[model samples]
Target: MTADTTGVNATTKGADAIDEAIAKGIDFDGTPIPTAKLELYTKVMALEANRQRSGVSNTMRSRIVRIGAKHIPQAELDQLLTDAGFAPLKEKEIAFFYGGK
Candidate 1:
């Protein structure tokens, strides 16, 4: 029997609609987006858009360190990276990402 594709299409359409609303600064619940929050987000995203990139792998590693450090302990994240065949966190990265924790 052929698989039904309608569910996937519906999900995609719903996501697209939500994205369109977000771009227009309208919340899904129909409230207008707060000006202060929107302005700050736009400014930060603009800066991120202009940031320099070294390479895909370096960028990936940086993102992993930045986000993973928020949710995982330092040693656990480092071991996970090594086990996944990525380079273990460097001293500088550890200091920067986990210094306060």
Candidate 2:
């Protein structure tokens, strides 16, 4: 799964973007975060949001975050996803409050 310069999901193109931007130091808009970084965060947040919509458990959510954190700085990544509109909630705490499925 990948996206192109137009932000349309096209694995090779997106990978190319990552390689071009991050690996090669290409710049499109003078944005602080590279194009690849933005795309990476966007996709990760979207996936997490989809998982939430599907009712993935708190344990599962934490696992997902942990996995993501391995790829990038955890605290910054967490804030980035939260700011992008992914609901920040604890799956385990949710279970405690409302019970689990």
Against the true structure, whose lDDT is highest? 1
What does the lDDT come to for candidate 1?
A: 0.76
Off by over 4 Å in 1: 1-32
Residue-level lDDT for 6 in candidate 2: 44
RMSD values, in order shown: 8.8, 14.1
lDDT, model 1, position 67: 83
Error in Å for residue 94 of model 1: 2.1
Candidate 2, residues 67-87, lDDT tens digits: the string is 555554545655755775664
Model 2 gets an lDDT of 0.51
lDDT of 1 at 2: 38
Clashing pairs in 1: none
Error of 2 at 73 (Å): 1.7
Count clashes in each candidate, considering only residues at least 3 apart in sequence or on different chains: 0, 3
* Candidate 2 wrongly placed segments (more than 4 Å): 1-66, 89-101
lDDT of 1 by residue, 1-101 (tens): 43333323343344476556546676655566788978898899789899997899888888788889988999999999999888999999889888887
The lDDT for every candidate, in the order shown, is 0.76, 0.51
